[model samples]
Every structure is written in structure tokens, then in C-alpha cells.
Target: MNRIPYANAVGAIMYTMTCTRPDVAYALGVTSRYQADPGEEHWKVVKTILKYLRRTKDQFLIYGDSDLKIEGYTDASFASDKDDSKSISGYVFTLNGGAVSSKSSKQATVADSVTEAEYIAASEAAKEAVWMKKFISELSVVPSIEESVPLLCDNTGAIAQAKEARSHQKSKHGLRRYHLIRALLNVETSEFKRLMERKMQQIHSLKHLVSKSLHETLDLGNINSIPNTDDYLWTHGAISDETLSLERTVCNDSTYMRLTVRGRRSQGCDYVFSRVSDEIGADVEHDDLLLPKCLSSSSAQFRPLGLHGKIHAAIARRANIGDPCLPERIFTYLNRPDVQKALHANTTHLPYLWHSCSGPLQYQQDNLDLNIIPLVLDILKEGIPILLFSGDQDSLIPLTQTRTIANILAKDAKLLTMDKYGPWYDGKQVGGWSQSFGEERDGKNVTSLTYATVRGAAHEVPFSSPSQALTLFLSFLKGSALPRPHA
Candidate 1:
């Protein structure tokens, strides 16, 4: 038995059991118990199960003809386990006349009677029913889902005892607190209507002024220039334009850096500089776009460039550069000499970078020390849903910084924790980790505030992790908390 690779064989069976064959669930559950130390008898049983799966490999679940009504059935076998006399609880939920969800597992406690065992199974189904009800509501296709979903069971006494909530000597089970974490939603573009809101909406952003006082301290403890090493450029694919601006603005460009990337679609290299470009390989033509009204004066009138990650207080976190040439190509494409001359043809300045002519925007040194925590608290008082998501590898604002800020905001707002820290999903794979804080009333979790960390994403989350970003945004827009992994 030790030589037969018992655990590996059982683990292989689990994938088939979870995805396609609920029929194998009970048998797999039974065999899985002996995976730790399977005897020769258990190895034979595992082989039999694998053989059975091989025979039924061609069988598939059929759907599409039946109505969309969700029907649930639950059953239990009392004292099914001979080792400990524990009851086995099982439930299956059907939609479109096919099994959409199913579970077969041992009960936490042993039930004394058949009715008690059946009731325990019903409770598990009840939780799933609530979850399905909410999920269907999110779909918005079914008009009659507001009504309570009906659960089918064979035992009549268990149903009556379930309606009577008071605990009795024979029935000794308690309800668990918290929302059901399992919600299966398709995040694909084809099923857009099934998961997301179709209505168009307008958003208004409140702009706050930055004070001239700079109080945000720069943490230059571990930051240093990689003069002749692979620590910076190689470890993290390459430095991004956003991080370049972040280095220049926050760290004052002490870590001198330059990146040269060639676009796959282009024949030439795309140039990027961490500081002001000195006009190197890029082709340039003389233009009069920057000639000031007072030509004798040297007071600069042109702004450098726009970078969203140049915020004063955000932390410097490291991440791999995923589309190295995209930003540089975009900048090059927008700042062509002919394009610049066509844009502003009359005046010019000593601007010899990609912009051969000076732009209308100039640099600003005003920094703010205002407390925006109170502003966030006021917004929370209005009870609008707020989702704050950060990339785990964001160089501008890291997940740790964002999480700490979120924790402080939740504490100040006097919100209760609705969803504890856990992994949320993009399809079956873990997309990221999330936690929600909200105001609860009437025994319902109304999640008005949530914070999520997108795994392996850069500062520009959508640009780096599009799939996970889409999932996070859709869940937030649907007023649903990030979907958690099934327990």
C-alpha cells in the first residue's frame, strides 16, 4: 500500500469529482480518509474508483432545456461511518435541471436519530439556498427570486422541527454567523449581462487642493542606485514610467536610471529616462512652440509631463515591469516633432526633450499636510459603498500601506468587520486577498466598505492584471463583496 502512491491517486480523483462527477463525491470522500495511511484494501478501492472513472469518462452533464428555477435536495445517512458513528450529510442544488452545486461530507457532530441527521443536511442546504438567492438577484433575470426558495427532503418530522427554532434535547445544532462565502460568477466578456450592471453611470470626483507645506517624510533607508548590478533592472523586469516619475518626484532622482525598450511592433528602440530627457537618439526638428511672450525672461512656462503615481505620500514598492515599451511608445507617438509643431507652432522654449516645444503645464512644489481621514469618515457617514483596491506589487502605493490605511479608516468610521481576511477568486484560481468592513443591521451583512489586494499586479492595476482587475471592479459595481474561495 505504501508503494502504490495512494494519496496521489486519490488527489487525482478529487479534480474529476469536483468539476464533473458529483457521483464520485461520496466514494471519494470515503476513500480520502485513508490517504494518510492507506492499507492494501484501500489501494484496491482507489484503483476500482479510477477504473470506474475511466469507463464513465465520456459521460457529460446536459443542460439548457429545463426552466431556470433553482431546486435543492438534501439527505443524510445516520451513523454512516463505522469508525466514529458519524452521520454523512449531503446536498445537491439544481438549476436548468442540472446539478449546479453539490456537496458530500461528514457532519461536525453525530446525530442520534434519522430526523436529526436529515435536519443537519437541510441546514447546510439552507445556507446554500440563501447564497443562490442572492446570486440569482445579482443576475437580475429571474423576476420571482425574491420569494423564498423551496428545499425538498424526505423526512416530514425534520421539516416540522426545523420550522420550530427552539432547541430541544434531541436537536442540538446552532446557526453560524457570517455570510456564505461561495459565489460562482462568470467573469468572461461573453456573459457580461449575467454578472454586471448594464446601465450607464456618471461619476463626479471631488478635487482637493494641495497645501504648500510638505510634511510627508521620504524613507530612503533601503533605496539606492543599481550602478552595476542586476538587482533592480533584472529582478523586476524594468522600471516603469510611473515608477520613474515616482523616483524623480519622491526620491529626488538620486537613483539615476534609464530604460531602453524596443516595442515588438516597432523596428527602433523606445527611449525612457527617469529624469528630464536630454534629447538623444529620438529625431527632433526645430519648432517655435516654446517662444515665451517675453523672450528675454528665463522663467520656465512649460510643465514636464503627467504621471499619476507622483503622489507625495505613497510608499515605494517593487514590482516586475510587464509591458515595458507601451508607455515609452505612447509618449514617443504623442511627442513627434511634426506632431509638436502642428500642436503649438508659434512659440518655443529651451525644451529639447521628446517635446521639442514646451507644454502649457509647469511643475508644482506645494505639498499638503491636511488630514483627509476625516473626509473619508464623512463619506462613510453618507453610507455609500467604497472599494479601495491596491496592487500587491505597486511601486507607488503598496498593499501593506493601503491595508494599514484601510484598517485605520474602518476603525475611525466605527464599521464592523463583515468579511474577514481571505482569498477571493477570479474563476477557480485565487485572484487576490480581501477583507470587508461594513455596517450590519437586521442580521444581514451590508458591505459598504471593502479593501482588496490584487496579487502580482503593478501600480497601474488594470494595465498589469487585467483579468483580476476586471473581476474586482465588476464585483464592486454589482454591490457584491469580492467572491471568496469555497470552503
Candidate 2:
């Protein structure tokens, strides 16, 4: 693979980018990643860049068309690379409508969100701004170079982060993403450093939450096939006049992996307050999870353990049932004084310190006759992205069932297959098998729906295989196509 003169061609391209052609910086940066172990695929990229250069050879950089003011533009493609989840940060400083300095490179650290990615990119650009400001001011070639440079950033969240202290205070998880004191705290600084931490940090689940309380509940609307929702059901027609309001828990903190969602029917805007453990669906149910057929056969054995106890016993064990030590660990954690203070076998209250709550011994389960594929299609039709993931090891919401649902949704949506089923990666190891489906928009295949399976993960993928889960999550958020196995 390394036999070709891949490095030489890359060097020439780099020279061309540095000398005059700033537009090629991004492509050059991506192609440079495979220089050490170049393959036929990577070699093709180099050739393509060469062809581009040949076609545009006549064009040259022209300056002095605009004012002497320097305009700095910074942008970032958040988690654009599939392999490492690193963002691509590019910045160009233009003087008199011609680029004087430009850089396209991978961020050293993984940004937690798009706003953070932009802030980090802006952070890097500030350094270049400072350097250019000084150089041009000393050269005295352009007026107002010593004044504050007109740095443009498209993301308002980043601007707020700089101006508002509360936003900066709330975002304390990924501080290394940018030097907050120097850049986000607002200023350009010394020479830029490329070593922004690129590795995906382990998700810190139990952070000191700033939401003031552990749990909050709101009144939500009807479920599918309910009295008011029947009008939108499959038999009625495929079209929905109203858009259902589905609100996912905000990723304000590190607890984004803990999915606590609230969905409402647009007809009545009614919802139920119930913290479902695992998935309440019958697909994940096992013999252990199911209650005894009658109280007579199980009454004596279950008389002491009330309904809530039995419910917790069955559901909690599913987390790590394979381990013999898990039961004792769960017992210890559950019996903690602090844990008991918050959870007292009855949930119908607020001001609690516990994370979430669940239903009583008996509850109203969803109707078996309802088919949610139509509802899913409605959401997809609204252009909202949907990601369906399953753990191969999960019994409850089995992988096969989720995969079938994903197929059904795709067929119903009439989406084209963007990438056929293939293995995606977390670092160098195989993380999972995934496939994407989407409709083309503006000459580009925009993946609106994805189905993936995390290898060796259980019902809760993140709990069992965090790294792979993180990989899947970042890909979905970035809207980047999953990397094929061979690549």
C-alpha cells in the first residue's frame, strides 16, 4: 500500500495550498491523513486533487479589490471524520478580498457539541488573528490592522458563550476543547497549538447537575391508537395533518445518554408522566420479567415482596444479569441511605434526589394492535433525523425486532440506501454494523435515518459498550456517513 509516491504528491499539493490556493486546504488536510499507509483509494484522492489543480491552473489569487480591512472567517465540521470523531476546524484570514493566511486541520480534542466545535475553531482562529494583526500592523501595509479584527462566526451559541458567563459556567465538561480563559473568555493570543485533545473522553454519567432538582414531570398528550390519535393511524390514511411534538432531553449536561423523552399528540397536546425502565415494549420481555399467571401459585413466594419490589427486582437485574456479583452490587446500591431517601417504593412526588421514577405494580401497556411505523414515517417526513440502534445481546427489544422496524420505516419513507450494511469503527476496533437510508437533497445524499447494532452490548448499549455507543452517537449527530469496514 505504501509503495506509491503518495507522500510526494501530497507535498506538492500542500505547497500549492500554501502558496496561493486556499480552497484546496480542506481536501489536502483530509488526504494527508492516509499518507503513511496510502492505499489505492487514498492514491485516487491524490490524483483527483492533482486533476483539480490542473483544471484551475490559470486562476490566481488577486488582492486589493476590497478595503484594507482583514476579514477572519472560522468554521468547523463537527465530528466530520468517522474514524476518530475529531472535528475539522478551518480558518482563513483574508485581506483586500484575497486570502493571506489559511489553515485546515483536525481539532486536537473532540467537541461535545456543534457549538463547542465552533467555539474551538474560533478559539484557534483568534490565534491566527492575533498573529496577523501584529504582522500587518508592523508592516504598516494595511490601515486598521491594529484594531479589533472582524472575525465572523455563524454559531450564536458560541457568541453567547463568550458574552454570557452563565453559558460558560454551565458548559464545564469539555473545557479542554478550547482555552476558555484565553479565547472564549474573549481574546487572541500566542502561537496556535494543534494538540487539541482528539480522543473521545469517557462519558461522565454522574455529574453535579445544575437543573436544581433530580426529577420534573409535565402533562403530556395521547399515545398512538388512542381515541384522539386514531385519525392519524395507518387505516385512516398515510398522511398526518399535524406534526407530533417530540422533545428529547436536552444535552445540556453529560447525561444526554440517559434518554428521558416526552412526546405529545398534536391533537390534544396531552401526555402521561411515567418513567419507563428499560423498554416497556413486549419485545424485551423475558420469563423473569413477566409476573406469575396467578397470585395463588406465586402469592406465598411474592407475598412479602410487594409489587414495586418485584418490578424493581426483575427490571434492575436485566442490566447485568449475567454477572453473579451484580445482584449484590445492586442490593448494596439500592439499600444505600442516600438512595432510599430519594426512592421509597412510591413515586408520586417531587423534590427527589433520585434520577428517575417508574410506574406502579400494575400499569396500562400500549395496545398491541397499534402500528407505530406510520407515526415514525410522519416524523421522518418532517425532516427530523431518527437513529435506531440495538444491542445484539439484548433480549428485551431484541436486535432483530428493531432492525425490522428500521427496514419498515425506510421502506415506508421510500428512502434510498446511502450505505449498505457494513461495520463501523471506534478507533481501530470494530464497533458495530450499520446502514444508512436517506433521500437526496440538492445533489447530496442526506442521511435522515440510520440503523445500527452494537456488538456485545446489552439493552442499554452505553452501559455495556460505551465506546461503541459514543461512536454511533457522534456519527448520528454529525450527519456523517458511517465508515465502511474495509476503509
Candidate 3:
């Protein structure tokens, strides 16, 4: 009946999750979500975990005297939480095949793709590994080992992102802290020198390919002017087939200058161009952006009939977008005293009424050009297995883009296609189209990359197609190919 003890019990179990038992971490995380308002279902789940832990209390780690090399393993459950939509990340470090340290935590930010979630998880594990290495160096002989601590991750795309230096647009939305692992991979330990050398060689080769492609595809031009400080007018002359020369001319004051350029012609008249100033003290001009004034001005200069009435109607209609009834219903529900009490929310009354998304949040678009192709190539070179999947219903990042990206990475990595493009299956029914790529080593085809689509699924595959997603996940974990149809 009481909710206070639920928080305390969850907190007590969380200590074990953080310190020793990684197996219980996911369950604890799930139960902790309902801590503020524990329902009967939540309490039952917590009780189940407590019963399981009681039965396993006799278990203890017995480290062997030999084989003390440090190794890390990481995995992530993407968008496991329906409420917050956050991925769950779990990692463990082992000494002599026994876990020395472990962690399970919800990802700090939402990941747009499975690769992003796995990459963030690996980065978190890398941070812990770095700390563990430093700690072991003081306590034991791990410092003398000449190999980089192997961090095993299931996703190849994430592994590639970590090894590559380029920022990809797909991964640019990832938080900056996740990219710190790339820097750590290069600098924290000298054991990764081989990887560094391979990365540099790949970079040099990539530069050559890019330069060659540009030269072959584009018209080249040479600069015609050099800078002269004494000259009042600065010019770059004309470059290539450009009609106008870029010139910067000084104004009456030395600190101020203006840049003039051509504008598109309309009805045999050249439109006025906006001028840019070079100095901080220059006064900037503002365009006529007021709605009524601009509408009147546009009507004066070649306008269509019914334009004003159509514009008014459009403006009035635009205000009522989205589910009209949903907002009012949500507002009514949140204002209820019982609901607020149950949620433990609205403790402090503010001047303004409660709103859904009124938090002061600003996003810095830092990684706009981050391309993860090179990173994928780096992971392929390391002979790690990677699986890339997309939901067919996801138009935001379509299956076409994912498949094309995989093909490009395969080409860059020089991986031979193991199977031609064809339909893969789940329980005798068509799951989606797929292809495999990798190399043959020691009489076995070592698959480095696999690409598949989940038919009828949306952005979050598991949410829409749980059974199919489960089948695909099991295949990935088993290190076996996706099921093929019978002949």
C-alpha cells in the first residue's frame, strides 16, 4: 500500500547492480522507473527479482591464479523503455574469466539508430576500461601487457564509428561525449599503435581517392589575384565560368567594407541584392518581413487574383494542426489533483500553468558532416562481425539509405558479397530482403557485415514488429546467418 519502502528496496538492489551483479541490472533498471508511483505490477516484478537473488546468494567469483588478462564485453537493448524511449547499456570487465567490474545504465540520450545506441554503450564501457587499466597498473602487472584491452561489441557499425575519425551525418546527432572514445582509443594506450597505423594508412588512401574523384568529375580553376594590403579594393578576379568577380571594397571608414554581388533577373529587371558588411561596427539593414506590409507590397508588384483571401484562409487553417482534441484532454488530465499526487509532480506552483515541453533546451549542431563509412571500414579491417538492419516503414531513415551505406562500406572494406540480394525469412513467411559480405579464412567464411530489413516495421522496429525483431536479434547473438527458406 505504501510507496516509500519501494524506493528504499530498489535503492538497495541498485547497489548490487552497480558493484557485482550485472545479470540483475536490466530488471532493476526496469523496476526503478516506477519508483515514484509503484503499481501492483511493479512491486510484483521487484519481488520476483528478490526471490531470484535469494536463490543465487551462494554464488561467488573464484578467480584462477593464471590467465589474468583484462577483457571487456558490451551489449545494448535499444529503446527498451517505452515511457522514456532510452536504450539500456550493459558492460562487464573480467579478470581470469570472472567479472571484476560491471554496470547497467539507461543511455543519457535518445539514439536515432541501433548503431548509435551500440556506439554509445561501447564508449561508456571504454571509459570504465580506461579507469580499470589505470587502477590495475598500480595494483598488478596489466601495464606490462603489449596488447590493447579487447572490447567486444556485437554491432559492426558502432565498432567502425569508434575507429574512424570522420563525423557522419547519421551519427552527428549523437552526444559529443560518445565520440571521446575515439580520442581515447588513440592516446590512452600504446598497445593500439597497430590500429593507429592502419587508420592513418586508410586515411591517406581515402584522400587519394577523393582527390582523384574530384579532379575527374569537376572543372578545375586557378586563382588569378593576390592580396595587396595597400589597395582600397580587394579582388579575387573571376574564377572559372563565374560571371561575377568577388570583390571587397573599403568604405569611407577603414574599418567598414561592402561586398557586392549579382542577383537573379525577373521580367527583364535585376532584383536588388543584399549586401554583406565586413566590419563589426557596420549597420545592417533589415528586410520588410511584417506579414501585412509584405503581403500588400507583393500585391503591388505582379500578383495573382484571390491571393489575399487565399493567404488569410491558409493562415487561419494552419493554427489548427495536429490532433485538436488531444491538447485539451491532456490539459484537463494534468490539472487533476489526484493524478498530480499519484505522479508526485507539481510540488511547486509557478506563475504559469503546467506545460508539456517548456524546458529550456538548446541543441548545438556540431557534427553535421560526420560520415561513419570510414569507421565501418576500420571495423571491417579488424574482422569484427556487424549487422545493420532497418524497418521498411521508417521513412525518416529509409531502408534504401541503409542498404546503400552498407554496400559502400563493403566496397571500401574490399569485402566480397557472400550472397546476392534476396528475400530472407522468419517462420516460413517473408521477413525482408538481405545480403551478406565478408572474407574466407581458415576454411570458414568469416562474415564481417550483414544487412537486412524488417518488413512492416517503423523507426523503432521492436515496438512495431516484436516477433520479427526477436528472431533477427537471436540470429545476431548466435553468430549464425538469418534463416533461409526451404527449397
The Cα local distance difference test for each model comes to 0.55, 0.57, 0.57
Q: What is the C-alpha lDDT profile of model 1 across 1-487, one tens digit per residue?
A: 5578888888988988787776666667778898788898888778777766664443334333224566666777789789999987777766645577887677888777898787677777777777788888999976656655656677775665555454545422444411111121111101001112322110000001011111121111111211211113223444455544443333322222211111111111112232223321111101111111211122322322224123210111223233322333455565677766777843474355543223756532122223456567788888788888876655334455567557767877788999999999998889899999998768877887899988766556676567888999999889988888767
lDDT of 2 by residue, 209-271 (tens): 111121111011112212222121212232122221111111110011111222211211122
Which stretch of 10 consecutive residues in model 1 shows the poorest summed lDDT? 202-211
Where is model 2 more than 4 Å wrong at Cα? 1-3, 167-487
| TM-score between model 2 and native | 0.36
lDDT of 3 by residue, 1-487 (tens): 4834788889988897677655566577668889888988888777767765654443334344454577777777789779999997777777656577777678888877788888888888888888877778778665434456777776778878888866666455444678878887787441221222222111112113212332132211100111111121122111111111221221111111111111111211111111212321122111101111122233243222122222221121112222212323455578787888789877785556665435654322233223455566777788788899986644334565577667767877788898778888889888888899989899888778999998765545664566788889898889888888867
The ten-residue window of minimal lDDT in model 3 covers 280-289
Model 1: residues with Cα > 4 Å off, grouped in runs: 1-323, 338-367
**Position 312, candidate 3: lDDT:** 27
- lDDT (0-100) at residue 324 of candidate 1? 27
